[model samples]
Target: MPAPVQLYVYDLSNGLAKQLSLQLTGKQIDGIWHTSVVVFGKEIFYGQGISITSPGQSHHGRPLQAIDMGETALDEETFNEYLEEMRQVYTADKYHLLDNNCNSFTNDCMGFLTGGSIPSWIKDLPADFLSTPFGAALRPTIDNMFRGPAQGGSSAPSSAQPLASSLLQSVAQNATGVQGSTSSYLPTPAATPSPPLAASSSIAGPIQICSNTQHFNNLLSTHKAVIAFFTSHTCPPCRIIEPVFERLASEKASAGVAFAKIDLGSAYGGGQIASVYGVRVTPTFLFFMGGKKTHELKGADAGELKAQVDLLTYQAFPPHPHASLPLRATRSISLEPILFTQSVNFEAVRSRLFSFIDLSALSDERKKSIENSITSTIIPYLKNKADEREGKGKGVNTSISSGAVCEAWRIASKDLIDNLQVKDIFPLADLLRLTLLDNPVAQWCSTTAAASGTSPPHAILERVASALRNEQQIPKPVLLTTLRMAANMFTQTVLARTILVTRSNGHHTSLTTLAISCLLHDDSLVRTAAASLVFNMAAFYQAPRMEALRSGRRGEAEEEGDGEWEVELLSAVLEAIKMEESNEDVLHRLVASLAFLLHLSPFYETQLKPMLEVLEARSTLLAKLEGVEGGFTVSKKEARALLEEVGTKLCG
Candidate 1:
């Protein structure tokens, strides 16, 4: 038995409190919390609830946000059963046609679909969708009966409340503004709807389940084990454990262990279910026997998950007590090799993606052919191009605008991001393993301190070094691009070691570095990159050559941001700057860097006088430029601030 199940939900949208309590109290029970609240870590849009309280017991809550999965602690296994049942209900006796109540008449009465916004495909329905034979059949419940022969879905929703108002609300609310945030906004589907049930009237326990608190109080008197498998479709661990839970559901339903699963959308818009549950990571299993949760499993793998489930299943669940796991700080191994290989498996992924595009809707065979051609050739072509731009190709110029280049990057992008997950790669496997063991900040808030994107620059450098040492011959373009990207990405202190290995006097001959130094590039971004690289020069052979350039003792053909001012060759760099004290922007930023250099060596007396003179000159020039107020604001403020700080320190 594990420790008593304890969850710390940060947001408590009380929408599903009732349904939640009931499903948890009974064995084989399930609940769908229609939390209007946003989601977290992932999406939380599963709106129906279900449970298997005792044979005679039952529970109910608000009209489901979507499907009305019956009462039970919903798990992957039982959820599938619910879908099958809904499908059967949809396929079976047309409730409107049944003699129960409808006269095929005024039943067109206003029906509120109430939850998610309707899907776009709804507009494609036939004109008579409301009054036609299909309409007449489904009019009583949903309206136009087109989806199937009967059940309420095929029918057109009545005119009083059009389909537009109700069907797709969930989908639209979570939509993203950019392709960047798209996956983060996707709604995670829970266990698929179960196979159809025999009849609405044939179930032993109450089929309709809800999260109402009142119903919850009444459910505790029955059943043995009620386990809530709070999960999400976006979670990697959840996928791993879903089948395991499914098997558990099948083997233990009659044995008295109940299951429930909730999609915690806390990571998205801060969905209430996740907020209330305080779910951060996935595969959180909360087990309850009688009315209270007895034990829980946090971060369970295959073996641990089975063990946890077994511990909670039979005799009253146990309470596990243990010290915190030890933390490890070193992150040496990587998961990149594995993930990249998988991303290149374009054929398989492409096939699966297109399988969802309904072919029946594609009318023109020519159009279909075009679609196939694009997917088969164009996409792959563009992807290869993007890889080349990213330095994945030999002897290719760095090009960001190539459509093929973007497409290839997207290929890597899609493979890495399978839903809310970044697939497991061996290179990252140990890195994540160790980073997580020691750094909580990196673990919980990855974007802040943890680096992840196409690839971290350090990781790329490491990959390059590894290949050179063992694999095929190292490509110069790959090495050069990696260095440029490294300078652009990490702080000097962070990438210092890697910078040493690849840079040398020969780097001047490297087209990659020369390309980066072009005057046409954005001055601000490129300047910052160049400075950062200069600050960390411990990697190359003949380090003093760089130091001599920096000191003005040796002058190279220098590239400036705007235009270069010609100067005679000098032995040290201070002389070059002194000789061209003409450009304001150049002087301002150099003065800015002086403070940094002073950090290493004190700016005492004799040296301070020259620095002060330049600072005063720049300040006067900038003040003249600032006469128009905000016109030259960046330079104006920067120059004045630079002088003020230097003067203060000198005086101090």
Candidate 2:
């Protein structure tokens, strides 16, 4: 049976409350109203406090209206889980009077339950009032008044008179622009929503059961890789592999592997589909890629299934370099802001940034121009480009705008490096880093060709790379930040290919050379970041190369100098592993990168023995050094399993 939903609305006062508040408090109270969702006959309310109040008790002599919102198909467990997630996002501490308040919570719940939002008039009341001239002028005072405490305390307004007056005062304050933190008022730049859930077959845990042949084929076609477990209701062996398959699916979902089960005895076309696939036995497993069968197995061997799935998962999407790394630092690293949608401590970061550079040579006007360009033009251009890529905005011409922004930054960067005797390079690199942090604008700028059919974006990156390579006195933080930004560029396949294949003056660009140089840097963090870059570049290149090879388009012909670079990268990683001291993060990245490079490269056999030897040595030492006061800390069992798994794959 579908679960019932009810929308309960309570007006704090009649029409007279608004006029009284304006005359007494000198502010317009749009309306003092509260809304809640009642599911399964429980009256749930969210405000300064969340409570399940008795249905009639919540009205408090005020006018009340209840609307039947139909029913929801969600099971109790799924609904509870979703509610928990909603609780995290709608935390009471983060609530604001005008922005994310009781109404916002109600709208979210209503949408989730009924697939429709509340009426727009009530939703837009606060925003509409704040747009007026008087509303604009009174906002600060209003925000300050309500910022004192959240409403609905244990010492609540008991009588209808006090409750109505207090609620009216609260709404008036909200109308005048009284709110929470400063970040609440600042408009978050809009971006396109992600593609609909149906477009991607990326699953998070759980083995999905396909209902019919069409369903099975659709999942296979949309997903990069799919593993189908064919079973029958009466087959006992199928039960053995059920739990194992679920566990493996959960572990590998993040790596882009999808798992499904088909009961051949079902009334759907499962029997016919199994016969077509030549599944003569129960508990048969079939692996598919690009709608073609790649591997098949009979019976229910959990170990073999795990190994095959693990191999296929890595082959599809390489593991994140830090996936297995155990945290060693007491505090986590602060993430850089997405300037478009996030609030940043601009003044603090800028003050620290200025101390690193000597601006005496450049006039105050020029310095201000540089700062203004970054704050006003460059940030917005990048933000817009990011939004456009995600299928958001009015389809702006980002290629031209982003190119201009990159050109401006390139000029500013060169000027600073030449004119200013930079006291510390870290701050400057950090500033540049923040601009491109996870925003693919840098890569797009580099790869997108100009009207002359010449790449201007490459020139910008080349300048940054040249500075890193030639400036021997550059601080470690500066070098690290520069390399991180460079790594981010390789996230785009075209940019990665350009970096790996492009050459200047009979040599690879300094950017590539700098990455290689950092592979053996004395600092562990630098080494890990560099290794991650190499892994990303190799993974991006391998996917298409492998596909081309499978299609017989690129037959066994390795790109020029590819082997040499792979060997150099592998050697550097092995040496880093041997030299690493108590840095689990470095060890994890090096191992993960090595696994990717080995599997993807043609030289796996040649490098296998030495790689295993290094791992064995490290594992032995790690065993003894485990839990020894910050000495080589890691999940020993996971480390051992990784080594064993890699060894088995190599030996086979």
Candidate 3:
């Protein structure tokens, strides 16, 4: 008997009961209260009840045993009757049962109206609940110290007590039907509170939030925005505002204001992400302007959060309101017309986002909602731009303010490049197919720069490259061409960036392969460019690649001679390099690249003899062209020595 199973039911929604007793609730047990179970009414999280008693003198004397000795369920109405009956049947022995036996678990709060001490269990519940990591990794890790020892750490365990309680309280109050103590009851949420809104006209305060470029792209595509709070459980100010967020997420769900929370990475020194947003403390709120960041709030309150949301959503998130009033409060909101009017076809995108009326939270549904919102708003804008170029007369320069000419080129001829697809892993082919080699998305990506008030083509390119690098699926050619063009035009970035990106294992190609390509290219610039990346990429695979070559040649006579593969590959590389040898500006990367290749696999032994002969002949020919004459000069001499060093590395 845990002090004889004395039941104390309390309702937080009603002030009198809450004041009379501390509340015990989770979504499993919210607003409704009951002692006697009736199918379903709210008596959740009743973990196994323990029959606590005075401990025996032995160290492991079986912790308090559980017994249903006086277990009872009371529905609100029946509970009232039960309470009345209990009052009548109350005796001195029951009071003694609680007063002396269970000090850790108290019924003291049971004597409510008059002040009484909180039970140890009530105080410890939060820590115990947090200790269980169920459905919680994605949730904000509010506390830095949440990992401290369970009970013997001397100091009190860190618990976002107030915030946790608020979260529990809201969930409990909103929940309607819940199964009781029995394990076999079918579970289902009878009535779920509506989720929060996705719009903001500005809840209050001038705040700006900056998103990484990818998120910026997604938001602009959907014509949507969000207010995010970066916080931690250990942060005092964050702890204070978390309750405000829980309250706001529920109360203003109908307002279309979206609220999100993020916990900084653990390595960030006690949640120091505020530094990126330029705030030095916890509880920083930011308001986003379109996809760009607008302002930051050093501290936040509920009113401020809600108001900022209301303000941003009304003024920024939506595209245009419709002509007719909705018959009911709908999950969808009209986009503001101002957004579409600026760009002739942007309106199509607006209608698209408006079509996503997901009033649910299943993962698949949520993914569809986000995807639909993006395609609807963005595709139309792209189409309109396409239509604008209908008859600009072939060869007529199409670089308007939006730069439609080059885009028209990519559109008129997309077949030159291959489009790739990976089934069921979320199709990105559609997105890649839309990429124009003459640079439509990058240019439109440039408009994002206007939103950011700076040309972010390089930043955008870097982000795209970063995304592409890790993509295990081969990238579509049009996308590669478009990015390559962007890299070229952004001259400051191309060489170093291409080299930087080439080293990444995202879809690695060997230096030997590129060297072979450069030797055979049609254009000097293209060949030179490929050769440069080959140099850097080879460094990472150097010795291992060299060893593989040596091993492949060791049994040349016994080989089935897939020599045609090597012959074709090397022929292509040499042709590419020979074509680009005209550009003196690229000579260094060429020589250094060749040097890098020769350094890895010796020219005489581990390679196709014909390709090396072709490459050396081309180099010797280039050296003879005025100052470009080449007989593997002193520099080439040094490079060859380094090659010798690489060849002898294993022997050493």
Which candidate number would show the highest TM-score if scored against the true structure? 2
Task: Rank by lDDT, highest first.
Answer: 2, 3, 1
TM-score of 2: 0.39
Clashes of each: 93, 4, 73
lDDT of each: 0.30, 0.51, 0.32
Off by more than 4 A, model 1:
1-221, 266-274, 317-652
Q: Candidate 3: which stretches are off by over 4 Å? A: 1-529, 543-571, 602-604, 608-611, 614-652
Candidate 1 lDDT trough over 10 residues, lowest sum: 103-112
Residue-by-residue lDDT tens digits, candidate 1, 1-652: 1111111111111232222211111111122112221111111112121112221111122223332211223243433343333232232222211111111110100000112222212111211122122222223232122112222122222221222222222212221111222112222232222233344332111111212222222223233566666666578878777777755543343213345445553222123334454656677876667767677677646677667667665355221111111111101111011011112344544554344232324435533553454365434553554465467773233332334432333333232222211111222222222222112212121121112212232333344444444544433334333334443332221122122222231222232233223212234433333333332221111122222222221111011111111010101112322332334454443334333232212122335345445445334433433443433333455565654443344222
Backbone clashes in candidate 3 total 73
Off by over 4 Å in 2: 1-344, 352-368, 380-404, 417-423, 437-440, 448-473, 505-509, 516-524, 545-561, 603-630, 636-640, 647-652
lDDT of 3: 0.32
Which rank order by TM-score, best down to worst? Answer: 2, 3, 1
Q: How does model 1 fare in lDDT?
A: 0.30
List model 2 lDDT by residue over 1-652, tens digit each.
7898877766544444453333222234545566777786666555433445555444232226777778887766665565554453344333445544566666666655666665665555554444322232233333344343212111211111232335445454332222333223322112111111221122212354553454455456545678888888689998777778866754443212457777776543456578778887889999987678889988889999988887676566544233333322201211111122222355555566555433447777777776666656555555554565567773343544645676667555645555544334444555554455433444433333211111333443454466656765555766676666556654333334344544432114555666667777888778767766665655544443343233221111232235656666666666666566666666655555555565545445454445556555345334433444445555655554454444345322
Error of 1 at 318 (Å): 12
